[model samples]
Target: MRIRFKLDGQDVEVDVKHTDTLLKVLKDRIGVGSVHFGCGEGSCGACMVLINGRLRYSCLTLAGYVDGKEVTTVAALARDGELTEIQRAFLENDAAQCGYCTPGMILTAKVLLEKNPSPSDEELFDALAGNLCRCTGYIPIINAIKSVSRR
Candidate 1:
């Protein structure tokens, strides 16, 4: 089926199979590098994307499910060679290691901050519970998210 959605602020149309996961479509067909393929079972947040402003696991979301929705990735958070505030905070705090989970973590953090600019540490932990970062632990990531809200 042919699906149409706004990807990273641009309109996109693609043909996908019923079994095609959103992760495959974004990485393979659309060539979106930020959405990583992790567990492929939605257990890991590596494939998280914002569909109509809500976080969803791209690995579990069928391509056709977002036929007319808005999909936002980390690539959209930056503009004209400048990083978004959250991105800058991540960089300042060294929130990434191995970089496998950075995109999802950043996206999740963005949503968390958006919904509650002053999330408690426990809330921050809960927001990032789905994302697993074997390296760098999560201190830097937590600091990055907290920094954004502080400013």
Candidate 2:
């Protein structure tokens, strides 16, 4: 089946199988390597992406389900070789260790900040609850979100 969607900031069309997950289509066919496949189940949140401005686990989302939607990955957060504020905060706070979960974390935080602008600590925790980072111990990650939210 042929699927069409807005990826990053460009309109993209590709042929995909019905069973193909968004993570596979993004990485394999579209050459988007940032969306990693950690657990293949939705539990890890490593494959998170924004579809029509909502966060969704790409590992469990079928390619066909996203047809005609807008898909944004971590790659979209950086523009003109400059990182977004959340990315900068993550770096300043040292939120990443292994770096496998940074993309999903940043994207999830992006959605949160966009909606709330100034979220409380609990709201930040709730926003990032779905994402898991085996490294960094989560304090720095929470601090990073707080830093960005305070700005």
Candidate 3:
């Protein structure tokens, strides 16, 4: 099947099989580097991306389902080689350890901040519940998100 959608503010069209997961297409066909393949079952939030302004696990999303929809990844968060506010916050807070989950974590934080510019600690925890990071122990991650709210 042929699918057309807006990817990181650019219109994209590609031919894919109905059984193809969006994660596979994004990383393989589209060559998007931010969306990682941690757990293909969607249990891990590693393949997260914003679809139509909401977070979706690309691993579970079928390519056909994204036809005509808008998708945003951590790659879109930065512009002109400059770090985005959230990305900078993550760096300043030392939120990443192994960095395998940083992209997904950042995108999740981005959505949370967009909905609530100033989220409480508990709210922040709840928003990031799906994203798992084995390295930083989450304090730094939370602090990173909080720092962005301060901006």
Candidates in order, TM-scores: namely 0.95, 0.93, 0.93
Q: How do the candidates rank by TM-score, highest first? A: 1, 2, 3
Best by lDDT: 1
Rank all candidate structures by their lDDT, best first, as comma-separated numbers: 1, 3, 2
**Clashes per candidate, residues 3 or more apart or on different chains:** 0, 0, 0
Candidate 1 lDDT over 20-115, as tens digits, reads: 999999999999998999999989899999999999999999999999999999889998999989999999998888999999999998899889
lDDT of 3: 0.90
Candidate 2: segments with Cα more than 4 A from true spot: none
Candidate 3 residue spans exceeding 4 A from truth? none
lDDT, candidate 2, residue 132?
92
C-alpha lDDT of all candidate models, in order? 0.93, 0.90, 0.90
The better-scoring model by TM-score among 1 and 3 is: 1
- Candidate 1 or 3, higher lDDT? 1
Ten-residue segment with the worst summed lDDT in candidate 2?
142-151
Q: What is the lDDT, from 0 to 100, of the residue 91 in candidate 2?
A: 94
What are the clashing pairs of model 2? none
State the lDDT of candidate 2 residue by residue for 66-105, as single tens digits. Answer: 9999999998888899998999999999999999999999
